[model samples]
Target chain A: MKVVALAGGVGGAKMADGLARVLPAEDLTIIVNTGDDFNHFGLRICPDLDTVCYTLAGLANSLTGWGRSEETWNALDSIRRLGGPDWFQLGDKDLGTHLERTRRLSQGEPLSKIVRDFSHSWGIAPLVLPMSDQPVETWVETQEMGWLPFQEYFVAQQCQPRVKKFAFKGVEQSLPAPGVLDALEQADCLVICPSNPWVSIAPILNVPGIKESCEGICVRVAVSPIVGGKAIKGPAAKMYEELGIAPSVLAVAESYRGLIDGLVIDAVDNSCRDELEAMGIHVLVTKTVMQDYIDRMNLAKETLEFCQKLMLYKGRQ
Target chain B: MKVVALAGGVGGAKMADGLARVLPAEDLTIIVNTGDDFNHFGLRICPDLDTVCYTLAGLANSLTGWGRSEETWNALDSIRRLGGPDWFQLGDKDLGTHLERTRRLSQGEPLSKIVRDFSHSWGIAPLVLPMSDQPVETWVETQEMGWLPFQEYFVAQQCQPRVKKFAFKGVEQSLPAPGVLDALEQADCLVICPSNPWVSIAPILNVPGIKESCEGICVRVAVSPIVGGKAIKGPAAKMYEELGIAPSVLAVAESYRGLIDGLVIDAVDNSCRDELEAMGIHVLVTKTVMQDYIDRMNLAKETLEFCQKLMLYKGRQ
Candidate 1:
């Protein structure tokens, strides 16, 4: 089946990678969040786009799930010595992406085209598209700091400030990238990968036509980022708690309530399956924690099968 | 005696390093050429200023006469991998200087202050100053290409293009940086380091009020970059030849005829001493080729002694 996966950073990249393993290169199109994109040291840096690209290319550091494997920090070490920003660690190999991307951007090339070119250069077969060609910066409102750029809150401050809300600046003006609408239109399934609902998927969905395009798809399924009341990665669970909501599979399902027809929750949260079913959402309880490559592939396989079941249920109705 | 040495890239940096070794930190100030500075990959790169700073900080690659010692090419290699401009090789450590300098410049900091801060951070004792806080880019008019930026001509084109002339863009409005005029006014002598007269020393002199300040000084001596009808390093000799002037000690002397009171030439060109004297300029014949640290120190000492003799001769006259 033709699959379109919406992804964020590491967690999303992991899920995207899993989907890539099951789907044909031409059949899978992974749309990556670009809300975390920021300019650092005068170079344009796209965290989620790079993560998805690296993971798909099999160049990601397996241990960290971000950055390149066997990456060198010589540039970062030198930057630190010169008293440049050391909070966001830019490895030598990864810096190539930012440097080239920035150069191209300055030369008037769009981010999507640059990402496309980079993916081709890295021998990536599956299509990886940034959510928008235009910038849509994610700004986080925190209790301590009024409004912090997503990276400043996430990376520089280590996500310490209590979460309030997120604003995807420029999202209203941004159109989904060139192939995004077409991918959604042609896809049999639209899978929202296990990424933060607020920062990651929200920014992508908030783009003008992206959500409406996904709504038109036959089967729309979402993999829960939260399992057993905690996020598998990043500050999603903490953000949920701070926002006065209990972090759970039901909360994740509710976050995507009307848009998604099926929800893929972890085995640990199976008790919520019946409750989710009662709310008219199909629930699939499976192992969602991707501890290894096999785990990623298995979760991906189950998610795809669940999408097929959702399609059958829709036909029966 | 308080001394100010005017310098450019590798050769000039060598002379500056020699002066730094012999003169106390408070007694010496090295004013470097900023004409060769350019923006590459969105980073402000000051070739001559960085060379002088690296040499003084003892971080320069002695063999290559530029860049950091034992530097890794990770950044350049990565840039190359991404098909970015790799013609201008930026080592990982060297990129640190460029990145920080660019950041500070973008933040509206003056180039001179940034250089001063970087020098202090590197533990460089002697003051290292760029000729101007304002940019004065050297554009070379060549037979092959009409006008190429200094780095494009020197590094990218490998100086293959026949020299026509050079224009110091913005030199007319550019003022000598802070402390430069004061250093000249209070200086006992001004030593024009053995750097390219046309591209390096000329740019500094071209700065408004700088050449006039040097003219007001009693003792002004220049060490000849040309020896045995050829430049010891770089394209100075070729430039002289291309400009229809014989690349010799006599030609070098004539280039600075009225501006300098004394000239330091290599021992091989001692035959031109009488001719230089006839032009109302004192000539000192010595070993000007600096192959090692001791050679640099000895050349610096001879250049200083030549200035002292010129001072004595002026007193006698």
Candidate 2:
């Protein structure tokens, strides 16, 4: 089946990698969130886009789940010694990507074009697209501080500030990046990778026509980022708690309600499956946590099968 | 005696380093050429300023006469792999300097301020200043190519293109950087380091009041970059030949003309002493080729003593 995946960083990258393993190059398109993209040291840094690209290219550091494997911090260390910002860790190899991207962006090339060129250079088969070519900044409103830019909150502050709400600057004006609508139109299913609902996937979905396009798809499956009351990674669960929602599979399903027809929950959250079905959403409970490459593939296989079942069920009805 | 040094890159840096060894930090000020500065990978790279700073800080790679010692090339290597520009070599440590400098420049900080802060971090005690706070790009007019930016000619084109002339884009509008005039005013002498007169020292002198300020100083001595009819390093000799001047101590003396009171030439050019003296310029012949630290120090010592003698001679007259 033709699949278009929406992804953020780490968890999303793992899920996207799984889908790439199962599908042919021509059949998969991964739309990465650019809301987290920011300029550091005068270079454009796309955290989620790089994570997805590097993970699929097998150049990602497995330990950090970000940056390149076997990376050095000579540049960052030097910046620190020079008294420049050292809060955000930028590895030398990863800096190569940022420097090139920033150079191209400053030359007036679009973000999507840069990502396509980088993916080709990286030997990545699956087509990777940033959510939009235009600049979209994700700003977080925190109780401690009035409002913090996404990276300042996520990386520098280590997510210590309680998030009041999240805002995607420029999202209202941004059109879906080229091929985004077409990919959604051609896809049999849309997989929302296990990324944060508020920041990662929200920014992509809120991009003008993306949500409406996804709504037209026959089957839309969302893998829960939260499992057993905590996020598998990042501050997704904490963000949920701060936003006044109990972090759970039900909350994840409700957040993506109306758009996603099927919810993929972890075995630990199977108790919520009956309630999800009662609320008119198809449910699939499996080992949703991806510990390794094998786990990613298995979860991907089951998710696609679930999508197939949901498609058939919708057609019969 | 308080000394002010005019410098550019490799040869200039070596001379500056030698001076730094002999003079106390409070007594020496090095004004570096910023004409070769350019933006690469979105970072402002001040080649001449960085070379002088790194050399003084003891962080310079002695063999290459540029960049940091024991540096890694992960960032540049990665940029190459990504099909980005890799013509100019930027070491990881060097990139940190560019990145921070670029960041500060974007935030409206002056180039001199950034250099001062960097020098402090590098433990360099001598004051380092760029020729101007405003950019003064050195563009080369070549026979092969009509016009190229200084770095495009020097680094990217490897200085192979036959020299026609040079144009400093903003030199007409740029004022001498803060402290430049003051350094000249209070100086016992001004030592023009053995750097390219065309690109390096020329750019500094062209900064409106700089050359005029130097003229007011009693002792103005220039070390000849040309030795044995060849440049000690870089494209100085080729440039002189291209400009229809035979590369020799006589050519070097005439290039400075009335601006320099004395000329320091290599021992091989001792025969030209009478000719230089006839032009009303005192001459000093010494082992001017600095192959090591001791040579640099020896050369610096002799040059300073030569300046002292010229000062004493002027006092007697």
Candidate 3:
């Protein structure tokens, strides 16, 4: 089946990688969130786009799930020695992406075009598209820090600030990048990978026409980022708790509510399936924590199969 | 005596390092050529300023006479892998300097202030300053390439292009950086380090009032970059030949003309001393090719002593 996956960073990149593994190159397109994109040390840095690209190209550090495998930090270490900011943890190999991207961007090339060219250079088969050509920064409103830019909240502050809400600046004006609408139109199913609902998927969905396009798809399934009352990674669960909502599979499903035709929950959250089905959403309980390449592939396989079942069920209805 | 040195890249930096070794930190100030500075892969790279700073800080690669001593090439290597330009050969540690400088420049910090802060951070004792806070890019007019930026001519093309002339784009309008004029005003003598006359020392002198300010000083001595009719390092001799002048101490002396009171030439070119003296300029023959720390110190000492003798002669005259 033709699949288009919406992704953020690590978890989303893992899910996208899983789909890339199982599907033909021509049949898969991954739309990555660019809301987390920021300029670090005067270089354009797109965290989620790079993560998805690196993961798909098989260059990602398996242990960290971000940055390149065997990456060096001579540049960052040197910057630190010179008393420059070192909070971002830029890797030498990963910095190449930012440097080249910044150069091209300054030369007036769009981010999407740079990502496309880089993917081709890295020998990546699957198409990786950023959510928008225009920037949409994710600003987080926190209890102590007020409003912090995404990277400061996520990386520098280590996500310790109590979350209030997220504002995706520029999302209202951002159009889906070239091929994004076409990919959604051609896809048999849209997979919302297990990324943070607020910062990651929200920014992509909030783009002017993206949600409407996804709504037109026959099958739309979301893999829960939260499992067993905590995020498999990142601050997704903590963000949920701070925003006055219980962090659970049901909360995740409810967040996607009318847009998603099916929800893929972890086995640990299987108890919420009956309630989710009662609310008119089809539910699939499976192992959602992707520990390795094999786990990613298996979960991807199950998610796609669930999409097929949901599409058939909708047709019968 | 308080000494101010005009410098460019390797040769100049070596001379500055030698001066730094012998003089107390408070006694020396090095004004570096920023004409060779350019934006590489979106980073503001200052070749001469960095070379002087690195040499003074004891971080320069002794073998290459540029870059960090224990530099890593992961960033540049990775950029090459992605089909990005590798012509500039930016080392990882070197990139940190560019990155931070670029960041600070973007934040509206003056280049001189940033250099001062960086010099202090690197434990460099002597004051290091760029010729101008405003950019003064050296564009080389070549027979083959028409016009190429300084680094493009020097590093990227390996200086093979036949030089016709040079244009310091902003030099006519640029003022000497904050401390540059004050440094010259306070100096007992100004020593033009053994760097390229066309691109290096000329650019610094071209900064509107800099040469005029030096004219007010009692002693102004320049060390010839040529020895045995060849440059000790870099494209100085080749450039002199291309510009229709035989590469010799006499040609170098003529290039400086009335601006300098004395010329320090290599012992191999002592034959030209009388001819240079005929032009009303005193000449000192010494071992001007600095190969190591001792060579740099000895050359610096000789250049300063030559200035003292010229000052004494001027007093008697």
Which residue pairs clash in candidate 2?
none
Tell me the TM-score of candidate 1's A chain.
Answer: 0.99
**Native contact fraction, candidates in order:** 0.63, 0.86, 0.76
Structure candidate 3, residue pairs in collision: none
List DockQ, one per candidate, in order.
0.65, 0.83, 0.76
lDDT of 3 by residue, A236-310 (tens): 999989999999988998899989989999999988989989988898999999999999999999999999898
Which stretches in model 1 have alpha-carbon errors above 4 Å? none
Model 2, backbone clash pairs (residues 3+ apart or across chains), number: 0
TM-scores, each model vs. reference? 0.98, 0.98, 0.97
TM-score of 3: 0.97
Each prediction's Cα lDDT score?
A: 0.91, 0.94, 0.91
Candidate 2 lDDT by residue in tens digits, A1-317: 89999999999999999999998989999999999999888788999999999999999999989889999999988999999999998899988899999989989998888899999999999999998998899999999988999999998999999999989999999988898999999999999999999999999999999999999988999999999999999999999899889999999988999999999999999899899999888999999999899999999999999999998898899
What tens-digit string does per-residue lDDT give for candidate 1 at A143-201? 99999999999999999999998999999999999999999999999999999999999
Model 1: how far residue B285 lies from native, Å: 2.1
Residue A302 accuracy (lDDT) in model 1? 95
iRMS per model in Å: 1.4, 0.8, 1.0
Residues B1-317 of candidate 3 have per-residue lDDT tens digits of: 88999999999999999888888889999999999999888789998999999999999999999899998898887788878898987998898889999999999999999999999999999999999999999999999999998888888899999999999998889989999999999998888888999999999999998998888878888888899999978999999889999999888889888878888888899889889989988888888888888998898777777777877888898
TM-score of chain B taken alone, every candidate? 0.98, 0.99, 0.98
TM-score for candidate 2: 0.98
| lDDT top scorer | 2
Model 3 CA lDDT for position A2: 88
